[model samples]
Target chain A: MIRTENLCKRYSRVEAVSDLNLDVRAGTVFGFVGENGAGKTTTMSILATLTQPTSGRAYVGGAEVTADAAAVRRQIGYMPDVFGVYDDLTVAEYLEFYGTAYGVTTPVIEARRAELLDMVRLTDKADAYVNTLSRGMQQRLGVARCLMHDPQVLILDEPASGLDPRSRIDMREIVKGLRERGKTVLISSHILPELADMCDEIGIIAHGKLVACAAVEVVAARANGQRQLAFDLLSGGQALAHAFRHERGVTDVLTCNETSVEILYSGSEEDQVALVRGVTLAGYPLKAVREVGASLEDLFLRLTEEPVLPSGA
Target chain B: MHNVLRGWVLHNPLLHKELRQRMRSGRTVLGLSMYLLIIGAVAFVFMYLNVQGQTLLLQPARTAELFTFLSYLQLALISFVTPGVAAGVISGERERQTLSVLLTTPLLPASVIFTKWVTSISFLSLLMIMTLPLYSIVFLFGGVAPSQVLAVFILQLITLGAIAGASIFWSTFIQRTGWSTVLSYATVGGIFLGAGVAGYLFDSLSTHMPDQGLWSMLSGICYTINPIYMQAALESSRGFFTPTFHNSLVESVFQTVKTHNLTSSGSWMFFMSVYVGGCLVLLGLCSWHLRPGTFAAAVRRFGRWLVR
Candidate 1:
C-alpha cells in the first residue's frame, strides 16, 4: 500500500531521512521503531504529503505521492503526533467538519461520524466540546477524525507517545481493530514491546537509515542460535562449568551465582540437547535449562548501536 | 466544482462561527458603540452649527450636500477600520494552532483563502449595515437620495473587500499575528501615502512646463492604477446629483469635489477592473504559497542547512 525508493530528505546540512526504502503491504500493521531524532517523524511527514522529500519518490495506494498528491491524499489518512482540536467544537461537529472537508456527503458523513465515534469508544463524548475532554479522549477524537473519510491507508505518528498505561492499551486495541477491518496502518512508536504485540511487520530505523525490516517472527528466528542460554544448576557448580568449558557448541559461560550459569552458544537444537545431557552426566544436578529468546527490545538496541570503525594505520 | 464549493463552504465553519462570535463579543459591541458615538457627535455638531446660523439652512441643496458629505466621511472611516477587522484572519488561525487541521483537509488552499477573505468582508459588511439608521437620519433632513447612498455603500464594500483581501494575503505570508497585522496596516498605509505623493509630484512637475511632462503622464498612470482612486471617481460620478456646500470643512479640504452624475466613465471602469483582477491574482498567489509541497520543500532545505 506504501512504497519509497531511495527516499532522501535533506535540510541544508542535515539529512533527516537518507536513502531509505520501505514497502508496507495492504492490511498489515507496520510498526516503525526509532529513538528520538531517528527520522521516524520526518518519514511519516513525507508520506503524509505534509513535507516534500529532497530526492526520490514515494507511492501511496498506487498513486505517486509527488505527482498525484491529491489522489494519494484521498486514499490516506494522516494523524500527526500532536494535532490541534477546535476548542469550541463538539466532538461530533469536529468530525463532521473534517468529513465535509474530505468531500463526504452530508448523510454519509453523519453515518460515518457515528461509526467512527463508536469505534474509538467516544460515542458518549460526541456532544462534548473537544477541549473539554481529557488528553486521551482528545487523542481518540484525532483517530476518529482520520477515519472520517474511510481512507484505505492510515499513518499514525506516535499515537501513544504521551498516553498513560491504560490509554496506551486502549490505543493498541483500536489499532488492532483497524487491522481487523482491513486497513493498512503505519504506526511509529518508541515502545518496542507494544509494537511487537501489535505490528504484523516491524522496521527499525537509526541515524536516518533503516537498519532492519522484517516480520517479527523472521527476525526472531534469525537470532535463534546466536541467543544466550541460561542454566540453573542446583549443585556441582565448579565441576559443571569445567565440563562445559570444552563443549563444542558453548562459546562462553559466566557463572552468576553458586547455582546459575549463563552461556553464549552457537548450535542446533540437537546439539543443545546433547550439551545439556553432557552437563547432567558430568555430575551437576540440572534444575532447569532454557534457551532465552531475544526480545524486540534487545533486537532494537543491537540494531541501533553504531558500528565500530577500524583504527587507521 | 460543485463538490469543491460545498466542501469549501462546509470546511470553514470558522467563517460563520467567527462572524457570530464577533457579533456577540464584548469587543465588537464596544467598537460598534464607539462608532455610533463618533458619528452621532459629528452629526450633532454639524446640525448645531447649521441651526445656530439660520442663513446656512435656507438652501435645500446645502442639506443634500451635508448628507453626501457625511456619507463620504463614513466611507473614509470604513477604509481605515476594515484592515483591523481582516489583518488577523489567517494569522490568527495559525496562532490558535488550528491552521494545520484546516490545511490538511481535502479542500484546496485557494478555497481556504477565499473563505477567509469573504468572512473578513462579511464582518465589516455587518457593521456597515448596522449603521444604516445613521444614513437614514441623513435622509430625514432632506437632500440625500437613496440611490446615491446605495452607490456609495456598494463602492465602499468593494474597496474594503480589496483592502481586506490584500491583508489576508499578507497574513498568510508572515509568521506572527501581531507582525502581520502591523505589516498589513503599514503596507496599505504605504500604498495610499506613496501614490498620493507620487501623484502630487507628477502634477507639479507637469504644470511647470507648457507641455504635459513625463511626471504628468506618470501621475495619470498611477491614479488609473490605484483602486482607491477608481472608487473615489466612481462615487463622485454616481453622486453628481447632490450640490456642494462651500462652507463645510470637507468642501474646503476637497476643493475639486465633483457633483453627482451616474454615467460610468471608461477610465473608472478600467481602474475597477484592474482592482478586482489584482485581488484575484493576489489570492491565487497566497494559496500557492500555502500549499504543502512548497512549504515542505522550503522547510526541508532549511532544516538540512541548519544541521550542518
Candidate 2:
C-alpha cells in the first residue's frame, strides 16, 4: 500500500505539488489523471523517493519514504516517463544488473528475470542490445526491469505516453497482468480512457491540486451535475437545435449534422420527458433520442476548464 | 570473512556491469598494449644510447634514469587517464537517466560511489600491474633498490587515488560530463601550475641569498604534495631496505618509505597524511551529495548554524 498526507513540493517560485492527500490500497491500480504540469509526475517522484517533498509524509508498504527510504525503495518499483538504457548491455544483462543492485538473491533474480522477461514478452530480445530495441520494446523492457526485484508496489509515470496504439494496448495488458499478480500499482497518464478501463479508482489533478478522487464510474458520473442528450431528427434538425438551446434545462446545443444534434441537458427525468413530449407534439419529425452517458473525458474537461481551488478550499 | 568478501564482490552488480562493458570491448586491450609499447620504446632508446656510447660503466646511472623516467611516465599516464575514466561516471549516469533509478534501488549512495571509484582504480591498477615486468627490468639493472621502487609505487598509487577522488567529486557535483571533465583537468592543472610557480620562485631566490624565502619552504612542501615531484625525492632515497614490519601492511609500507630523507624532514609524512585525509573527505562529500535535496538540506543546516 502507498499513502501520502498533505504532500507538497515547491521549487523556488513554483509550487509543483500542493497539499496532495492520496491512499492506494494493497492490490488495486489507482490511475492519476492530469494534464501537462498538473503535478502528476511530481507526486509520483515524491512517492518513488527521487525527490523530497517540501512538507508532509509519504509511506509505501508502511515505511516512510524519507525517514526510512531504504525500506520503501525495497517495496516499490518505479518507472519514469522517459528513461535511458545502457546501450552497451543486452536486455538480460540490464535486468540482471538492476536485480543485483536491488539486492535480490542469485537464484531468485535468475528465476524472476525469466518470468518477467516472459511477462513483458522480451524473452526473445534477451540477448539483444537494449539500444537496438524499439521504443515500445524498451518500455516493455522497463516494465520487466521494474519487476525484477519482485516489488510489492509499482509507481509507473506515463508508462504508455508515446507508445503506438498497439503498444499502449500491450502495456495495458501487462498492467492487467500485474493486477492479476496482486501488485499495487499507482499509474499516471494523460490518457483518460486508458485509465478508465484499467483503474479501480482515479484521481484527477488540476493546477497542482487534486480536484476529484473517486471510483472510476463515480468520477465519470459526477460531471458538474449535467449530462448530454443526442437528438437524431429526420427533418427540421437546425430548427430543433435552435429551440433546444432556449429550453429551460438545456445549457447548449451542438448540431452534429443536418439530422443529428446533441443538447447539454441539466434537469430531472420528468423535465427531460416533458421536453421530448413537446418536441413530438409540435409536429417535428423526431426520429430518436438517447441520453449520453458522462465519460471521464467530459469530467476531466469540466474539472480543468475553470481555475481549480486548492484542496482545502 | 570469505563469505563477506564473496558477497561484497558478488553483490556489487554495478562493479561487475562496469567491468563487463569496459573489458568486453577491444579498447582496454588496446590501451594496455599501447602502454607497454611506450614503456618499451623508452627503454629501447636508452639501451641504444648506452650501447652506442659503449658505457657499461654508466649502466647503473642509466638504469636509475630509466626507472625515474618510466615512473614519471606512469604518473603522467595516470593523470591523463583518471579524469577520462572518472569524470563522466556519475554525471553520465544522471544524463542517461539511470542515476534516479539507481538511487531508488536499495543500493546506498556510498555503495554507488565506492563501486565507481573502485572500478576506475582497478583498471589503472591493472595497467600498473601489467607493466611490472618492464619495471622489473629497471629494478635488476640499477643501484635502485626494492624499497625505493615500492616507495615510488606507493606514491603513484596515492597519486591515482588523489586524482580519482578529485575527478569523481567533480563528476558528482557537476551536471554535465563535458563540464565535469574540464573541471577535473583544471583541478590537476591548477595543482601543477601552483607547484611550478613555487618551484620557479624557489630557484630564483636560492640563487641569491642564504635565505631560502617562503617559496623555498612552499616549494619543498609542494614537492611532497604533488606525487609527480614526490617521486624524485623517492628515487634519490636509500638504495636498500631494512623494514621491521611490526605494524600493519599500510603502516609498514609508509614506514619503509619513511626511512627516506624526505620523511626525516617531516614534510613528506605531513603532506601524505593531509593529502590522504583530504581525498577521503572529498569522497565522502561526493557520496553525501548524491542524495536528493541534500543541497537544500545542507543549506538549511548552515543557515541554522549561522543563526545559532
Question: Evaluated with lDDT, which candidate comes out highest?
Answer: 2
Off by over 4 Å in 1: A217-225, A228-302, A305-313, B1-73, B209-211, B224-235, B238-253, B256-264, B292-308
Task: Tell me how candidate 2 scores on lDDT.
Answer: 0.81
**Candidate 2: clashing pairs of residues:** none
What would the DockQ be for model 1? 0.33
lDDT tens digits by residue: candidate 1, A202-252: 888887888777797666546343657888877666666666688888787
Instruction: Calculate each model's fnat, 2 decimals.
Output: 0.34, 0.74
Task: Identify the runs in model 2 with alpha carbons over 4 angstroms from their true place.
Answer: A230-246, A253-262, A269-302, B1-7, B53-58, B199-217, B240-265, B292-308
* Top DockQ prediction, candidate number: 2
lDDT of 2 by residue, B1-308 (tens): 78655655666788899889877768888988887888788777866765576644546666766676677788888788888888999999999988888888877677788888888888888888887888898666665777777777878888788888889999999999999999999988866666655654665676675875664565566555756556655665554423222337424234424433354558677767866887888888897889955445456768888999
Candidate 2 lDDT score at position A95: 93
Which number leads on TM-score? 2
